[model samples]
Target: MAGRHWPGAEPLLPRLSRSANHGVLWFGAAACIATFGGSARARRAALRGVASLAVASATINTVGKGAVRRERPVLDAVPVIRRLKQQPFTTSFPSGHAASAAAFATGVALESKRWGAVVAPVAAAVIASRVYTGVHYPSDVLAGAALGAGAAFALRGVVPTRGQLPAPGRPPTEAPVLPTGQGLVLVVNRESGSATAASALIRDALPLAELVECASADLSGALEDAAERCVALGVCGGDGTINRAAAVAAAHGLPLAVFPGGTLNHFAYDLGIETVRDTAVALASGSAVRVDLGRIRPGPEGPDGPDGCFVNAFSLGVYPELVRTREHWAPRIGGWPAGVLAAFEALRGKSPLEAELQGRRRRLWLVFVGNGMFQRMGPMPGRRHNLADGLLDVRVVHGGRTPGLRLLAAAVAGPLTRSPVHAAVRRRRVRLSGLAPGTPYAYDGEVARSGTELMIDKLPEALTVYCPMTAA
Candidate 1:
């Protein structure tokens, strides 16, 4: 627009060339990305801070440029300011420079008040420089300044009333446990795993309600028998071990609780139930927040595999390797650090598989079709980023150089979202095939046999899991 109106006017290029103005914009973007890297609360705060800047920048640029649509130097309009050129056209209502500077200030504020104070002046100076550069009229800059200040002022900070920092350094105690009581049914995974862990979880959770154990081969029957009594069905095992339990719970409209005892409890972890203790507490007192679950057709498991609903995620491709790695190695190392290391060792020799996105074929080493967000990790796009959101965050990994190692590398360094080879595009339904039985596949963090063909779809708000007050 500026180029068109001010065909001959002082072009925006000369002003943009100066280090101070454009430099600040780059700095602001970096600041936002960095701020978002902090823990959950801080990231949301950072985003809130940037909101005003975005609004102000857009408004200033529009208003100032529109107001000034000044004719360029080459045009016939009398040039009060040096006509960089008569604007090829006219009227500049909002000053983009001013808007850009103001938006930059808003981003700076998210860092801290002190930094906010420093950036504010720099932004103002940048706006003033636009006028001195002769690309903008004084009025243009003044309007930009007004827009910028309004934005800076608007983005004070977002304060969550209830979750506000308690005493400066202390984590707020869990919300006063309400008289939270629900009819819980315990279902154990009699599959091949440390029965002790599931047993311990079952025993610990027994005080909560009814208990029953079902053999992996007959999980469906066991679940059907126990579903009637459960208001919340607590499953004890790896994700697959409890798949039937979840199916029953969903069928009966009951909330489900998980005891993550498997080697790779990705679904459990994604559910924010990383530890036995976390899941236990959630079972005991957490508030239920409804979330989406996915149902896989032509079941990912074997022939006897009961038609099931998954609470965490479902996938094909390199998912098997991830499950195997997490299962085999996580136990030895313990917790996240160990789980990650285990993944590294597992990926060392795996081959990536080829797949397609909307029919465009590509090679994928790891694919995680996810339902929930990993705390501290930003949202998995296209899905509400909420477990309760009825859509799935289907992720596709174009396993790079060393497929396995890439998984391990990305895990420690960061997710592979930006990896040149890693790409994710959302879909309502996905068909996965070309893998044999005994080959790995996962649904809710449990490894199931990948077979002839697998179809996965978002179950749409099918779960009711406990959540913190704020999360609710």
Candidate 2:
């Protein structure tokens, strides 16, 4: 009726609704726009939108529609010629389209405020079109918008928006004064991404510090040698390299300094050292914090043996395969794209690992245990606000009664929500057994074949790590 009063806009309104005929088409278009028409950050923001849409659609179509069961608005007053081309068959108390649009727009805005500004108007227009087409009441759309926005907020707890920061809480631990660059031994993995550049930056910032370039084979020896004579052990590499440094530092009773130089510098970022320059500042200021470390003991020796430590996270089952596939294809296709491909490949015909969790037998798709609570920041998991809390974040993806649909649902819904196939627990110790001998597992991004049993425990305030004063 409003469109009829404003005849000039009627033609375009229908066209817009038709373009978004199904929520999928509009979301696909949004993905394409994010990928091709925006910056890298915008592309990441768009993915969060996609995830929020999935969660909103599932919640609205299931609970929202089933609970209310409101009748659709009658089209008797609508002009027959102007009615929706294809009428919806379901009850219309809450509009699914409006829910999806609102969820996606809210999710995107959480990631990129600027991109959200661009998407909000379009989402609003889509919600309005539902009523203009005579399929929904204004009240129905309003309820749907609320549902969608709620879904987006729910996911924000598990999925971080782009460039997200650590949540505010207690102040970080202050550090005592120490040597800046003198007697500092910094090690770099030459093969790791941008190592040369990172090394140059580190040297420029800490000219008195000694820099050593080593390959994966020589890494352990070089670190041990450095720890013997140096006041501090520093490393610029990926999670795998950082894991090694942590082990050596712990054994030698030396403080560790890390610079983010790898594809995923999860440990370094958690320490508030995102770049070599940050490391330099931390070193000069002698700012440091004590953090806990995760230790994993296997039933029998395979490669890394019964004793090992992870500074970040540990995973078993399809996760290791996903990591391997991502590494193989990341250089050619890019990290995020490769991860998408890897996820599909890993999930195909995947069988859950049979294990005993807390003495209950269960079949699970993946088991992830983090050294400390790792929050969702952006595309990657975020830094732990309290690294020395001495707690482990254990997440399990269950096969449940049905594997395929349930697993897929949990993935899109974000890991924090309740699902038949997903669960998370926090503790200081977790034990698992009944694994086949020589099962492959990933810790801090490196895969290792280990024996059946696994014991995970946390060491409180195990190591001291240097970081910028601002991190405190």
Candidate 3:
């Protein structure tokens, strides 16, 4: 064993080794951190750490120890008390404790640099303790550490760590088009993430602006009333809330101000208004831009053919079920995990949708339409720089094969925005027919039952909104 000469530290190291037996204690601690942190980032880091440890353990126990077939060090020189419970029956070429420690630390670091930094010292201690307990050699711990780190790096290709999503690059100019906070009505969703803090921040930043806080049930009416009162309607919520606010703002001919106050503020980030402070700066400088919104004309379900609007994207088929599952699990398990779980559940044994694409009948797994041009090439599609391009980024997954196989292709294919499995094009208008009556659709994170036939159109420069002047 590596540390037999250092008898003075044997007692502490042995006890620490016992506590980490099978890495159960460490996993439990990580779960606690994730559960208590109360944020999606923390939860994701915890889950990734657990996954890393599992990979490391499996590799070391199954492959490393088995392949090497090295024997554990004899305990003749080890302390009597320490030797009793610290004996590891597995081969000694690579230490499992060291592997788990390195794997978890590296995995967490990949997710959050700050949390990773905090865990690094603890992981180092655990790795050192393995050798100190006289069960493994120093070289064994080093080799295990190398293997664990390598595994974490390799897994990065499959799992996403960062919570901050990418947005469009900044445009070239900085021009102000709207005045500071004057005639602005800011409506905040009280139930959204950090709502109280965001509301306070917004009020402090834009003192001249009128502020309203409303529950989700009353959101539509509150938005309608707020739109009637201000020159520019400011919305502080998630994508769904922003979508509704956009519809009201467009109807009332009001420019919109987006303040990021909800979980996953995709639209606000794309507009270069990542925080309440950013919105404040943009409003103070009178910065604004014009973006396109997608208009969905009602089909057979509606008697009057009323128009519906979405600010982000719209999709039918598997996505609607996935969204529902994600929303149901998000509150308990956090966002990213919920999304992953939902994708699997929705894709399992799912049937393709039968619809007419431009009058041609086809079997489709999903039909996606973006408000404007979106980055269509990666695992996650992004926002467009030319928001007023008057083109809808339409993508469809044809049912040429099983739904599972098509989804797998999408996952493996890099830059799916242009993949063959993903039939994509930019169009001003797209008509989808042959949908069953009351088929659920997801638009901007909100689910609704729509009519069989749907007419989706890109209204060019239809929405003028407050944004950072240099936003892409």
Candidate 4:
């Protein structure tokens, strides 16, 4: 292949081969995809792409080269202009460049088809450049690419993609069909991440809908007003904002349409709504489903406290402090960086919360209650597959001197019925007492102060929300 070169290809092909020396070109591509792709799927694709590349590179260097030990091809017949300046010293039986390129491309394709199409051409060029640079025989490049593709598939078996799992099986509910978004009022939080840009897209997609842009403080009043004026209520924000909107929608007997406008939209993504377009399509066709909402109320003999609802999760102890700290730093730094800082700040010099769970006294570092059953997909707790299961996923970490180590061990152990450091169970209702007066709690990313006693349970199939049933 190097003996005969075509016109106008020498400069580009040689540069491409050299740029992919140690997977630098692929890493840069992954960074760009994570930054500009804008959706959760795009971020997943970027992460998987880098992971596949790492596996492929490791296999080629450690196993492929050592096993074959083949000599490099002679460059006598090849033109010096198309040849690489620094020839590779490793064996030529399997090309590492080809393996990395193919692995990254295949991994990305498994997550997102559009991004995969954009990345595949570059990967193909990098694979061909290895042979064109007179570094390897054609057979070596082919074998390396096969191995790379196999690596991606093997990784998929260990960690299944989102597409491989079934969508959340929510019971279908009926709603009004608003083709142009008539009779629908969408309240947008201007302070949320990407919300300002999403507002413009929502205007173009659903022009007839009344859009109310407000700050975090005014969200409650705006949602209350919109609930009274419109037949269906819509919200564009993070989990906290969606929690408020869901409460108002349920009280007013109105269906909710959620447009993901926050940094990490846990509730919206769980409902198969990733973008404004997804919710808009659902509203146009009146496609929706009924899901359960988690509630926290006063105990039988406790003070008359106001009832609250959580659409995602409710937690006590260090988690509430972590959410508070993260919000404080997220404006200065980015979300991911702020979360790391918050974890360190929240866990430092913190004491465990002493509470009674179902009349049993327990000392815990963290207590988590999910709206529905949460399963562990990989190393961490993943999304729910059935939103109306009428079960609360209860997990707790026992008090320990090394809080960080205990939490890490609990996470690594996955969801277990019983363990030395942690325990997990599925319950219909949970009762807690003996909390210190004015104890702090967090629900759906919002922090609040609670009384000494609390009753936690689910309101099954109580809220109807717009979501595409066929969405992956």
Candidate 5:
């Protein structure tokens, strides 16, 4: 194994790391300080520059990780692995830490040619940390370095080669448009599920897949109607449409996919596919890996107990409000602005209800349970909260007013699970109560079923995913 059997970080960070793995992090850290650290003032400047590069690397990597959840070697069934450190919560995709270090070293090198010699060696050393620590494959480290350097150099466009820092709070620019193929089938959302918008996306994505416009007059007919074709199902709507599309695809065994055309394309990001172009190309070019899906049964919805199926995160409370808000605004503007409008729209609704999940009783303001992954920050890069994992990341929220205002603060800024304002709760199964009939509940992004009770459970390894850039 090129990657080593190293000691863990909690123990390693403080001590002279023992052998088992020696070359990477030890030398990497040493090189970083030695090459970058100079006279007191010069070293301070280098440290600042390095830190900036690291932050930039982490941000871009995080988004890409969410957008490209490459599976880790940990997923392999064989026993060639021995974890030397605490396993990261993330999968190994475009290594964030390494990329950041590489970018930092690269940036510092650009500042001085003499520094360049030292910087390149140190950057290479840092790349060694991941593989040497046994947390990443050799390939993982290399890709991370490449991405980090790219992001660092890219930031220069915003910050300038020698001056002016980049603007804060600027979301990543729209995904660069790509020339797509000429075959596409557009799914339209006439009902709240976004069949109509999907049709528009298909109009635009015609070069990608063959388009067939499908819509449910309402939530009830969408799944049955959309499942007719077995080709890859690409949804251009929100969680609801994705749910309906996924349910239809799950039953039909057709590959299900997504475009961020809806309220939140949690499934798309989890799969590491972004933009219609990203989705179109990935579906056309990527291979299929087995993945899990979530199924739900409603106590008394208009549909057969199964409210729907989900390939991404699902939740209650605020999530439903989030969807409802978007539904109200989709006709006006179809992107993040609709989400922003929806946040304010939710403020017109009710407060968190007291409820019981699986047997635990608690008062909550909101609850979030996801299938793919969850990051208030768009996609959680490097980790797929795999629907196939069979476990839902359940979160319970309470004590926040949905109608009070502050859209961003109310949307992702708050965690239903942890907050003095809310009770952080996690469970495998849940029974909800203390709400009115027709109280909106969300599964993926399907329209809220006006039901009083819901029955939910985790189904493991339910779906297969195609990961092209995957590594050990």
Candidate 6:
């Protein structure tokens, strides 16, 4: 192939070969995909692409190249213009460039087929360039590409993609089918992240539906007002805003439609609703499901406390403090930067909370309670496969001197029954007592003060939510 010159290959192949050195070409492609690809799915594809590239590069440099000592192909037959100016000095049994290209392309494809198609041609060009530049043999490129694809599959096995996970376990429920979204009223929190753009998209998709945009302070009233006037209650905002909407919808006995307009729409994403179109389609088709709503109430023999519900998770510890700090700075700066700053500020002088958990007195740094059983996908606690599983996913990080180090270890350890620093359990309800007055806790990104005692439990199949039945 190198000896026989192909038309339009002389100038492009050598430059492509040089550009792919040290995986620069693939990294650039990943960056572009992340920035311009538009959706969360695209961002995930870009992340997976770079992660696969890293794995393939590491394997090729540390193991593949060392396992075989084959030298580079001689440049005698290759044309001068097609050859790379800086000849590779490493063994050529497996082409590192080919490996990186194939891994990135395969990883992206695994997440999103459309993006994979866009990247496939560039990857193929890089692979061809490896051989055209007289740096690797045809067999070497083939072997490397195969190894790279294998690495992507291997990584997926360990950390399954969103499509690979089981669908949310809520049972199908009856809903009013408004094909043009006539009977639905959506409340959009203009202060929430991306709410303005998402509101526009929702408006376009559901032309007949009524939309009410309001500030954060008026979100609850807006949701309640929308629920009173419509057959179905729809909300577009962050988790906290959605939590408020959920309570109103439940009270009004209306099916809820959720549009992901928040910085992180954990509940909406867990229900397989990523874009406004997802909820729109569900509303049009009357496709809906009943999911569990977690509640925190005043425990027995305690002072009267405010009752609240969370669509996602509830936590008491440094995490609540982090949320408080993040909220304080989030309005001044941006969400991501504020979160980073808040983490440092929240943990600096924080101490553990002493409370009686399930009648057992324990010193704890963090207490996390998920509405349903949460699974570990990769390094983090990911989505819930069953939203109505009737179990509280309880995880506790033991109090220690170094709150930062203990939290890091807990995150790294994933879910465990009992570790030295952390423990996890599943229960229908968990009680907490003997707490210091006005202990701060967070539910669905909203921080609040807790009373002396609290009872956390799940309401089985409580809220009917609109979600596309065909979604993965």
- lDDT at position 88, candidate 1: 20
Tens-digit lDDT string for candidate 2 (1-472) = 4335545547766666666655765577567757554233566678888888899999987888899988888888877666778888999989998898898899888877888898899888888888888888889989989989989989998766535565423234544344447878899998776676788888777878899999978999999999998888988888899999999998888888888777667677666665667777877787777788899887654346438899988888788998999889988998779989998888787777798877888988878888888664111245577777788887777765445565556556554644666776788998888777777889998888767778889878778888787775
Write the residue-wise lDDT of candidate 1 on 53-167 in tens digits.
5667566545545655564322234344433332323345456567656655665555444445755765666665555445566666677667766775565544221123231
**Once superposed on the true structure, which residue ranges of model 4 sit more than 4 Å away at CA?**
300-305, 377-380
lDDT of 5 by residue, 169-245 (tens): 11111222223533223355554333454456545655555554445455436445555643445456665666666
Q: How many residue pairs of model 3 clash at the backbone?
A: 5
Q: Tens digits of per-residue lDDT for model 3 on 1-472?
A: 5534764556566676777788876787688868665445566688888898888888888899988877777667665665635366778988888888899999888886777898898788778877666778788899999999888877776664454344444323333334446688888888776666788777777777888899989998999998876777888888888999988887888878887667777777667666677677777776667788898887765436458888888898899999999999988998779999999998888788888888999888888888777754433356565667778887778776577788667656655456666677778899988778788889988888876788899776777777765554
Query: For each candidate, what is the lDDT?
Result: 0.55, 0.78, 0.77, 0.89, 0.52, 0.87
Model 6, 312-388: lDDT tens digits are: 89999888898988999998999989999998987898889899999999999999999888886111357788888
Candidate 6 residues lying further than 4 Å off, grouped into runs, are 3-11, 299-306, 377-380
The top-ranked prediction according to lDDT is 4
Give the candidates in order of lDDT, highest first. Answer: 4, 6, 2, 3, 1, 5
For each candidate, give its TM-score against the true structure. Answer: 0.49, 0.64, 0.71, 0.96, 0.51, 0.93
Question: Which of 1 and 4 is the better model by lDDT?
Answer: 4
After best superposition, candidate 4 residue 209: deviation in angstroms?
Answer: 1.3
Candidate 2, overall lDDT? Answer: 0.78
Better candidate by lDDT, 1 or 6 = 6
Cα error, candidate 6, residue 425 (Å): 0.9
Highest TM-score scorer:
4
RMSD of each: 14.8, 8.5, 5.7, 1.7, 19.3, 2.3
lDDT of 4: 0.89
Please state the error at residue 310 of candidate 5 in Å.
2.4
lDDT of 3: 0.77
TM-score of 2: 0.64
